[model samples]
Target: MSVIEKFSLKDSLAIVTGGAGLLGKQHVEALIEAGADVIIFDINENALEETKKYFLKKYNTDVLSLKVDITNEDEILKAKEKIFKHFSKFPNILINNAAIDPKFEKNSAVNKSRLENFDARQWNLEISVGLTGAMLCSKIFGAEMAKNKRGIILNIASDLGVIAPDQRLYKQDGLKDEEQNVKPVTYSVIKHGLIGLTKYIATYWADKGVRCNAFAPGGVFNNHSDEFVNKIAQLIPMKRMANLDEYKASVVFLCSDASSYMNGATLNMDGGRSVW
Candidate 1:
């Protein structure tokens, strides 16, 4: 195939976890634009319906959306069966994009965000969904890909995966050290663990013609306080948070054959935040 043709995902089927989410929807859009059949696996039934409807009308393509709780192995398997029923071949593109970033109201107790005060239950849930879920999807879906001897597994990591979160960026003036709502430690841990998982899967499936890589993105602008945006932007060399759709093309590149040689690596599109 020619260079431009290598980027085409025609005849490819991609299953994106958290497909109804902000960036998840963007990844689906990118993949569909590249001519790939896409399936969305997310736990939010309402959001899943909305995403399917939006894409159907927008692209005039019947993008499938299944309400899947990735944390549950049974749900993953069932979702897989449903996928198999809908398509002739097993899906070859797996995007491990399901992750939870803790959100709390400003009036809520800020001390809960502190590491010392963080609950184990929250940690377990976050890790299970973010890290464990990815592994399960890869193990089940990728097993079939290995049978075919061709696949791409892309993990959605974060810039914080490369560098620690600057707690100062989340600092509230009146709050004490323990009362500030810093970025939750689980976000960093989950993202960092994803990169490690990417490397592990890449080597494990090397001989099976399966490639794995991580897509690390910096913060995206989604309506935050002006003070917060400026605080984080100053630390990034780009001097601003990314637009919502900015990461779409990069995601397409990583998942397509264009990145055929990029295995066990992280394509960090962080606007120079990790470097700075």
Candidate 2:
């Protein structure tokens, strides 16, 4: 049998947090393709329901979409109980895809002059969702995996976490034109922390058969402008951002038994952007 067939999830259950977002929905779609029953945990009830409708129609698989807050342990625990009651056990796979990328959502033009003005509140929101949410989900679901001696936790990190950013991107956040570095303070800080968390948990539970790892994807154009997307494309060695298939493939590997031996390693799925 091929890897897709042999590596099928079959009776396994996979829980993906932030399942309503751009990347989160991709994770859910990949899990369903691999034959795993999936449960989506996100705060957006409408988006979650929409995702459920999409999958139900396409794959004809039963997908559970739970409207829960990732930052709240009580909400997660309650969702866990429901999952257990329905599936009889905790999920064998956990994909931490929910994150907040701190960039201008509405503005497209680059203003090199106004580099020092930024919302501290925006930065905090990024950290809370990107870092805190990942930590919480791991603590909750990882414990269950340890007891069963089988589980895979995939943390979605970013390439920016590895390298410093150019001042232009953050020039509006307060950087002189001559400054060589301009990092998005909050997003970068949190992704760095997530890598540390993955290593810590991997070593702490190596004997329990739970493998924790990460995938740092570069420049995925979900809803960004063409100008912004093309600019990021130039930096990559492959000269382009990854397509949906590329992202889906990497995620599927981490979810399936093909990566059973992998732990605490962050795979750079940047289309060779980090090298340049």
Candidate 3:
């Protein structure tokens, strides 16, 4: 196929978890722009409906939005049934984008997210949403894709997954050492775990025509404090946080035939942060 044709997702069906969030919405748009029928699974009913209406108006593509709790197997199975009812078949692409990454912004009231005083309950909640949720989705949705002997699973990871979290980026002054709102330990753990999950899924389904891969991105600029942005910029060779739309092209490449031969790989598109 020509390189241009390789990028086309005209006949593809993609399901993006957390598809109503900041980055997830962009993933939906990218897939739709590539001519793929898209489905969104997010727990936020309001955001999900809004995303569905907005995208429906903007693109002339089939878009289904479902309110799903990814951590629950029953919910995931129900979602699969709905897919069959609506789209007549299972999706070829599953974007494991749902996560509970607590922001460690300065002055934020983050008492339990700090590792020093982190609550075990909070850990379980984040892990369930970030790691376990992805697993459940993969297990339920991936089986259907395998029956067709073709699929792509893309896990949304972070630059911190490849490298250790630089706690300094989140440090706030005038607080006790215990009160310092460092990057939550759960965030790093979950991201790193996703990369591991990607590898396992890749090998497990290689013979079934499935490709599992991931991408590690640096901070995306979302009106973060100038202090935080500048601090992170210094670590990246590009010297700037990524724009909200920067990941759209990469997602299209990975989810479409463009990355047909690619599996068990993770592209670290982190503005040179991991290398630095």
Best by lDDT: 1
Give lDDT tens digits, candidate 1, residues 1-276.
Answer: 899898899999999999999999999999999999999999889999999999989999898899889999999898888898999778999999998868755646656767887889988989999999999999999899899999999999999889999989988887666667878889989999999999999999989999999999999999999999989889989899999999999888998889989999998898899998
TM-score of 1: 0.97
Most TM-score-accurate candidate: 1
- Clashing pairs for model 2 are 115-171, 115-172, 115-173, 115-174, 116-174
Which residue pairs collide, candidate 1? none
lDDT of each: 0.92, 0.80, 0.90
TM-score, predicted candidate 2 vs. hidden true structure: 0.87
Question: Among all windows of ten consecutive residues in candidate 2, which has the lowest summed lDDT?
Answer: 106-115
Rate residue 40 of model 2 by lDDT. 94
lDDT at 253, model 3: 95
Deviation in angstroms for 43 in model 2? Answer: 1.0
Candidate 1 residue runs with Cα over 4 Å from true position: 105-110
Q: What shift in Å separates residue 33 of candidate 2 from its native position after superposition? A: 0.6
Off by over 4 Å in 3: 103-110
Q: Write the per-residue lDDT of candidate 2 for residues 1-276, one digit (tens) a residue.
A: 676565677777999888888888888888888788999998888998899999989999779999988878899889999999999889999998887645453343442222365466766677778888888899999999999999999888888767655445333334345442345567577777878888998998889999999888876666766665666767778877767656887788888887878899999888887888
Tens digits of lDDT, candidate 3, 236-264: 99999999999999999999889999999
- What RMSD value applies to candidate 1? 1.1
